[model samples]
Target chain A: MTARRLPSGDFDVEQLTPGVRRPIKLRPWLIFAGVVVVAFFGLIFSRVSLDRSGFELDDLEEQIAIEEARRGDLRVEVARLQDPNRINAIAAEIGLVYPTVRIEIEVPGLDVEGIDPEFRWAQLKAVLTAQP
Target chain B: MVLGVAFVVAWAGIGFRIVRVQGFEADKHAERGEQQRVRTEALTAPRGTIYDRDGVELAVSIDAVTVTANPSHMEDPAAAARLLAPLVGVPKSVLKERFTKPDSQFAYIARRLESAQAQEIRDMVEETEMAGVYFTSEPKRIYPAGDLASQVIGFVRDDDMAGLEGLEWKYDEALAGTPGQQIVERDPYGNPIPQGEFVVDPAQPGADIILTIDREISSAAQQILAQAVKDYNALAGTVLVMDILTGEVLAMVNAPTFDPNDRSDANPEAYRNRAVTDVYEPGSTLKVVTLAAALEEGVVTPSSILKVPGTLEVGDKEYTDVGRTKAKKMSVAEIVAKSSNVGTILIQDLLGNEKHYEYLSAFGLGQVASGDLPGEASGRLENVRDWCDTTCGPSTAIGYRVDVTPLQMASVFSAIANDGVLVEPHVVREVISADGTRQRYEPTERPVVSEETARVMRVLLQGVVESGTGSRALVDLYTVGGKTGTTEKFVPGEGYSEEDRIASFIGIAPIDEPRIVVAIVLDSPSGETEDGSDMRFGGVSAAPVFAAIAEAALHRLGVPPNVR
Candidate 1:
């Protein structure tokens, strides 16, 4: 340690330790107060978000219940519409009656003609004519 | 020094309390706090739906609202009743009387209200600021097809919706699902708490059921049976239509049926599925069985000749043909076609007691047609050991001593239709669970007779429908075979009711291929029509019903008509 005097007669003291060193002052209580304030605000923000999400979950659940009720209503409606008696009544209302007779047509066997050039052309033309 | 001692004692008391709270009382306090917030809620699972073979909904469960109230908490009973009377469809006086009970903790205002009705009532109650009124979700059973197959589908009780009859009662457990529970922590005002202990046990839903019934055919048969009962002025009627191949009961319909939806107007008598539940003498229909047994034993052929007298004697009793005068030599097929009692008794006499009893047992007599249906009567077929005193042989031959259900008789014809293979009659086709797992039902089958004998029997039956007793049962554009039955109703105190006769006809359609068998029975049918036409004979009465139902069923199944 060394002391030096200026012209104004004020003495300045200096530390001469090996290597450059700076004396730093720290207020631990202030740092701790800053961290505590940050943490408290974060907790409040988190609680608000959680409460908001909880309300959102409740709303979603209520929506799901409503959808289920609507689905039940639709199912009941489908069942009502598919009733056979109703179908019969509607058929009768449309002036449609049950068929008293059923008929089935039998297909005749086919016989092939000669397959020359003119005959093939004639077969193709016949098919073309049958398209409509 | 004295003041210092008192301060020390106070400090010691505070320290002791802190230790007690932090140690032994801590768990107890924590449990009490959890109980204040944690609530157990029930999770209800939906019941299964019932469908027909082609996937049409027959019965279904729908959500409904049950309105309940704590009567003691009601501010004004009269006002509450007045507000809810019309909405709940309950009389205002009844509601007032129920709500006026001051000490009652809970009472049902209404059960199974429609969605709109429940919503209206809820809004009204909220608008009035009524207290202690609550609504809960209830599962309600609805049969959309109404009375189409009411007896087969049956009805469930309003309370708890438990099955009370028919297939509903038989497969109740399979259709009812398990309820689950959930426990979650809630705040003081009943809101769920975030980051709280929550647990859930999910509900397991019930399994669905698919029946073997054809809805269209069933509806058609029901309508035909109803019209028949009305037209003939009969007490009741039943029709059983089944596929001969798989023994699937397509339609089992009964007249005078009640709608299960509004069960208050339904009669308990109409609840019985007559085809399976009621028993009656099968009359001449059983003659086919006798002839079949005789042919199966190689004792007679279709062309075999038999000396059939007008009257035949057995023990001390005499059985006579309906309208015969003298002895006649007739072929076995001719005898069966005529439904001669003397010929059937001769066949029964040749079949003897032991073979006859064995044949009856083999034909599914004295046993229920096992299936999902409940309350089946096996009918009365006495064993030969207990038949010593009775004139069992001749009487049973003429279908007098034995009693059989319409289902059993239909099955007998179905056996002949299916080439002598008697398959068990069943209603349920498959049971499907919520997870898409299926449990299918396989029918039980047994061979009743040789195919050759069945073919011969088919030939004999064709004669009956073509030119014999059941000639009126002929269908256009198809070959038909059937047997007619006209039996006197047996009374308990009396021997038999001469006025009340059960007319029935069991028929197999498209006899060359034999796809379906239909049996129809009319109880106490009028002996004469309104125009003085005779309607007493089974061939005249029940055979036409058989024709109409068979025609509709065959067309619905897309069976091509091969007109002869």
Candidate 2:
């Protein structure tokens, strides 16, 4: 083995051995600061993803609500058609009568002036035959 | 120095490999990312609506709430199932099985709930504290009038609210609108992105459909039909009302109908719309068509007399009249009143086999009615051109060797009653979409006979109502023109069963001014008067149904009784 000279003028291979010593000094505050930065980034990423997901869910729920409301309206219309009164009213329009009408007639201007000449004309033989 | 050189080479190799991987397979990784995100969602298209001729709502689709679940998120599937069991009436085991499946994300829990029931279910779902439980909106078909013209309106199915039968099925394409889809991108939280470029292609709502049925007449026909069915104690019964003036079907009904709202476990055949679907021997009602041909050809006139017999033999087959003696001479009016089998045969001869069949074809027989239903029968005709020799010629007369639907019979009679105008039978009146765009079904009038012939036929038919077998059909306030039919039921092995019979009647009221024409059928009655509707014989069994419907419908339609 060849002898290696170190910066401190030591010729010992054991002191400079691999995995034995880490000479660089590390400050505890600096380590803490680095860890906080990573954690904050991770938390922000997670919150943004959740917010986006939440907004989508709200929109889907809104669409479902609109559809459900429309379905309810259709059910209501069906119920209306089933109503006995409604059916009866419609029936009346088609000419079905409980007391079935035989017929109804209206004659206008029946009070016209008519000659009562039958009584007088029969005795007088009415008018003479007209000459040319 | 040697080790440092070796380390430098290793570092260069590693750097070169990283560059190759990033550059060469870049597109491959991007494709995988897209595969994981893209999804195709199902777009539900709304089925069409069925309307009465007068624009009354008959069948329509409404949005409805359905309970849905994401099985992966169910915390306590068994517990949730137990709580939901009573209200939904679904087995707890079934629900548990679905929720436990990891791959099954969505499952239908309950379907098309009523508003109050849906609200209650929503409350229960919230109370369950399950993670994946949710609600979905789907289209549910609704029939506004319960049991009104049900056979004509038909019903739909589960899974998809597709029309399974009736006009709902016929106009399905027009009513079923286009469906569009929305693909959603969500994070691990199962939330969809709001503006995820919606990729939205707008869905089109189904077109509206309108029918030509008058609500007033429909209800009246149903009322009369129900009574006759009950009184007869028959297996099944139907009454169809149509406008003679315009071939529009006013009301089409069949009793003992299953409601469309809850249509599970119904008989496959019960769902069969008998008005257009079932065909049977029409008996003597066909005499008019044969007689019309004969009279129109100038082969016979109203004053013409026929020597009727009790039984006449055309071939080896012998036809018996309604017990009228053979060689009994009578006017055409008397022939109809007596319903002589021999007279109809003679009339069929005069009209000739060709002319007689021509008249039948002209009345829309052997042709599927172009209604909304696909299964409508063309009734039964041998195709005159295809007719074989032997007794098949005149045997086709008097409603034998032939078949007809109750609807066909109604339309046929409607022509005679409506001043010779033949109208196509239609069910829907109009269709309206969600945004209120509407489409209407209008009546089509076809002249099948001369007005003189129709008028003369009316007088002859009135005789059948006054003195013939249809005597039981006379309404209190108006004269009725009608005909009775009692055809032997066709049996599989024995050919014709003597014990089983089909009694039917078709009629129109106020003969002086015709309006409605109705046909009623009682399939195999018990001859029992146990019920309020059935009475066996056509007049006894079916005519009363006509009276009830006509009474109510006329009153509703504002048709005045003949008087003053």
Candidate 3:
């Protein structure tokens, strides 16, 4: 310890102590705490990602199921509309009667053209083009 | 020193146990843990859809639900049974009996409930906090066309979705797809653990089928058959419309039919696809085959003259004409037009027994049509060597001793319509797999007769519809060629009955360029019309049905009318 003089002859003391030397020791508790914090956040991150993916998978599954059900419903509706008796009744209601007059157009080799393999492409083209 | 020794002994014991548990017993404990966390479930695949030629839905499989339960998980079995009985449409007593055994692990509450109905039950269960009830997705068959082609399309088994009849049964292997499996981790409440190991194997859906039937034509055919059955007061009826060129069965309908969707009330007899499954004597329709054979062999021409008689003696039995007219000189064409029994017998004698049998066999008689339909009968044909009856030759010629399905009879006429080619008749045209691969079937063709002979027979048949027995079969804007058949139904162990008659007609349209063949058969049709007029003859009863069906079918098929 050393003492220094202040103004007016009053002594202000200054103490000088010798530096003490100590050995470095490893603290397992601090390491453990750090590891636990990192692990907790990692687990949270993974759980959030997993939950998001799972929800997406569930949504896609629900969508597929809904689509399949809709397709079944549409098919049934289409068939109902195509019913012949219903169409016939509708036609009758609209005053469309069956034709009574007979007409035949005589074209030479007409039957052969329908059966010929070489002419099939032309017929198919005509049919496709005829569709509205 | 003694305390130290005791402590060391205890330490050794502890270390040994740690080694034993960590090394030797690890696999067993790990397996036990996995079993608790892992579950295996079956993935349900959807059944196939069936469509008509024009992409009309005929049969489809819709989403459904099946209710199942684990009895051990049920909090109150008695209460559960009471709650579920009415919802599942089962008897309360039966449900209570099922719940009596506590040891029972699982029970089925209901199967194949509609989606809306199942959803209501599920919501109720959840709201009531029911513990044991569970639902599984299933598929139920729906025939949107109802009884339109019921016998042809058939129905599937409720539990396994297996086909039981008709084309469904025949093509079951091609229709049913492979099932899949999945392994997933679930919690105690059966909810999937999102973070746990989850593996999935997706199910593969079944193939779709496209049929050769035209819905419009088929519905029209069904309408005609039903009306014929009602008008004639017939017990039942069958009709078939075939595309001559492709040998595609455009329409096949049967009266006394049942809807496959509501099979609980369907009659067993109504399940038969009578066109290919039932056999009857074809009567005068067989005469066309006989005439074709005779003409092909040059034994008779269209103008070949024959001395016709009212009755022809065959063995001890007499084959008499229906009209009992005096014997007159008539051409072979007149014989077919008049449907004279004695004239047909004369024509058959020219071909003799062996040639006639061979021709009949060649025309697809006495053979299975090999259609993709279950329970098709190979109509009865006695061998030439088994001709024990002295009247077999003449009787078979006039369609009495032999039996033929309407399908076979139609094919015979279709052969002539198809320019002498006898193509195999089929209903299924294409099969589309789940993977979008398509397989189309080609019709098997066989030369039944020469083209020249077929044309000549077509001309002769045209006479029958023009001014003869089948005049009623003529359409308004189209020419028709056909044969009228009226046969006495044969009784078991007895001869042909006089009261019960089968009136039938098979007609080809647009005679110059044939496109469709319509065949109609009315079983035991009454002898009176709605106007109280006598209408027992095929020319009167069956011909008009054929006319109406063929007319509509031709119009729907887009075949232009041919008239000269």
Candidate 4:
């Protein structure tokens, strides 16, 4: 091996004497250890965020599923309430009459339903509360 | 040495074979593995949309959810059924029975759910883990304009939700688009994996239907008829409104209609489109046809004088006058206004039965309108040959044994309204494809009578509405022209029931321009009095209905106030 001069202007000829010992360098190992510790903490934080976001997505999807079901039921309800014979029969039972239009429904107390001031106010309140 | 050399060569050959097999099969094995994990997407066709003539939405389909289950996957089948019973509207025992075999793959746990119910269940699902339960997207049809124009629009079926009546039945194929397909590869666990690069086929949506029905005009006609039904105390009624110029029916209504969206509260009879299907012997309305035939054949003129008597005796049978009044000399127009049986029969004898048949055929009698319906009736016309020897010819001349649907009679009047041109009644405007491509249907026309004869007939009819039996059908804003038919319904063994009578009236509006033609018929009226014992005239019952309908329909159509 060719010897190179150091800043100390010294070059070693023998590798080491069996009896003679020197301390090990700690700079490279320490730098590598520091990088690994920082990487481990980053991984822990990332894992926590991924779990939390996945749960939120799951909750939103579940809510969407419920909404879809509700819409289907509304279809059934509209069909039921607007039925001609049913409405007419109800009107007859309540003695409510209608104009000649073919698709009219009359429930009992139809006039009251239309003109009752208290009922109208209740309707207004219901609308404000999104209950109607 | 030889054995060692042979072993070395064999080992090298074995090594090459292993590399060749593993390298070549790598792609094939990977593809097979991916297939096991892939899932398929099941896409259903979207329902078609319904619109009114004026670009208004009447019915539409909305997104929904349905819960289905694989009974075999449930660890506790009984428990699962009990849990799902309330949501599905089924008994827990029934669900348990379904899940008993465990071989039954899919059981519908619950069907279309409302938003609230879905929310409650979804909340429950999250609050409590309900595994092995799956939900899919479904669609439910909704009618925004509930029950409006229901008789014409018809209703869909319960099972497949197909249009079974009215325009719903006519353009079903066009409204229901061809369902497309999406073939998907599913895993053994039925879990879906999106093969992002794989081919996926989207479903074709149904085309939009455009009906020739005018909603406002229809409602207006209905309102008028409804009032008549009430005032007259008639059993059931029908109102048909048609554009005289185009022969396009603006609205046709039959009482006791059903909501298409909810068919549970409906009767099978409500599905009947009485405008074309129900036929009755059009009493005096038939007299107009007889009168038209005589005039068309030059057998009689408008000013021709007739010597009228209280009763006319023919072959030992006597037909009495409507009011038992004394004999009087009257013009042909006066005969129509007074509805004189003798006047009509005298002309019938002059025109001959053959001539009468010819006129009836021209007026769209003895045949169906041949519309979109598959089973339209021919209405009963036994070819004049079946006339009951003694009363046959005369009775027919006075409107008997010849059943006529309200629509057919309306078409005849519409011909008179349109100056002798008969136009076929059309409902469907176009048949469209899934991709918005459309094939249009044009209005069809045929000349039935001479313009001269039609003009004379119009004058006679207007006189009837203005001063005769149809005076009840007069509209204040416009001059109306029409005829009334009141006939006693014959009971088989009872001859003619005292109370059973069919009252009918048909009218044309704005006699100057002739816009709409309407007809109303009431069957089997109940109320009877001694003073007005024979008061079951079309004027008292059907004529008022015609009036109400004409008034409402004109207002709805935005007819300018120029009906002089």
The top-ranked prediction according to TM-score is 1
User: Which order, best to worst by lDDT?
Assistant: 1, 3, 4, 2
Report per-candidate DockQ. Answer: 0.34, 0.15, 0.36, 0.13
> Model 4: per-residue lDDT, tens digit, A1-132?
799865552645344346666778999899999999888888877877765665565557666765655554565466546444355567779989644443322233435645787776666565556622
Q: Across residues B208-233, which tens digit of lDDT does each residue of candidate 1 receive?
A: 99999998899889988999998887
What lDDT score belongs to each candidate, Candidate 1 first?
0.86, 0.73, 0.85, 0.74
Per residue, candidate 2 scores C-alpha lDDT tens digits across B1-564 of 999989998998998877776678768876775556655676787666565655456676766778888777877777877877787888988987877776888888888875567778777777755577777677777777766766677777766766678766776666778887867665455555544434766677777777776665766666666666666667887777776776667777777676676666556566667888889988888888777777777878888987776777766888887555557888888878777777888787777778878888887877765465557888888888887565777677788888888888888888888877778776655667757876665656677788888888888888998898787777766777888887888876888876777888888867789888878888876565544533556766776666666666666667777733
lDDT at B557, model 3: 81
Which window of ten consecutive residues has the lowest lDDT sum in model 1 chain B?
B527-536
Q: Which ten residues in a row have the lowest lDDT in candidate 2 chain B?
A: B189-198
Runs in model 4 deviating more than 4 A are: A1-132, B1-44, B70-106, B114-120, B127-129, B188-191, B196-198, B223-233, B384-390, B490-498, B528-535, B562-564
Each candidate's fnat, listed in order, reads: 0.38, 0.25, 0.62, 0.25
**Two-chain complex of model 4, DockQ on C-alpha atoms against the true structure:** 0.13
Predicted chain B of candidate 1, TM-score versus the true chain B? 0.89
RMSD (CA, Å), each prediction: 6.0, 13.5, 8.3, 10.7
- Kindly report which residue pairs in candidate 4 clash with one another: A70-B114, A70-B115, A73-B113, A73-B114, A100-B222, A100-B223, A101-B223, B39-B193
Per-residue lDDT tens digits for candidate 4, residues B1-564, read: 999999999998998887776787778877887667554555656667666666455566666567777877777888878877886778999888877764688877676654565555666666667666777656666666566777777656644557777766766676666665555555475533233224467767777877677776665666566666666676677888888988888788877566776877778777777787887888888887898778877888999998877778888777765875687888999989878887788778788877787788878888887566544677877786665656667878988878788888888899988988999876666656677688776777898878888899889999999888888788876888898888887666877667788888888887777899988887765564344644367777778778877887787787754543
lDDT of each residue in A15-125, candidate 3, tens digit only: 222465454556887798899999999999888988988878866875677567656666676777777767888998999986565333333345664577657656666
TM-scores of the models, in the order given: 0.85, 0.76, 0.83, 0.72
- In DockQ terms, which candidate is top? 3
**What ranking emerges by TM-score with the best candidate at the front?**
1, 3, 2, 4
* CA lDDT, candidate 3, residue B551: 90
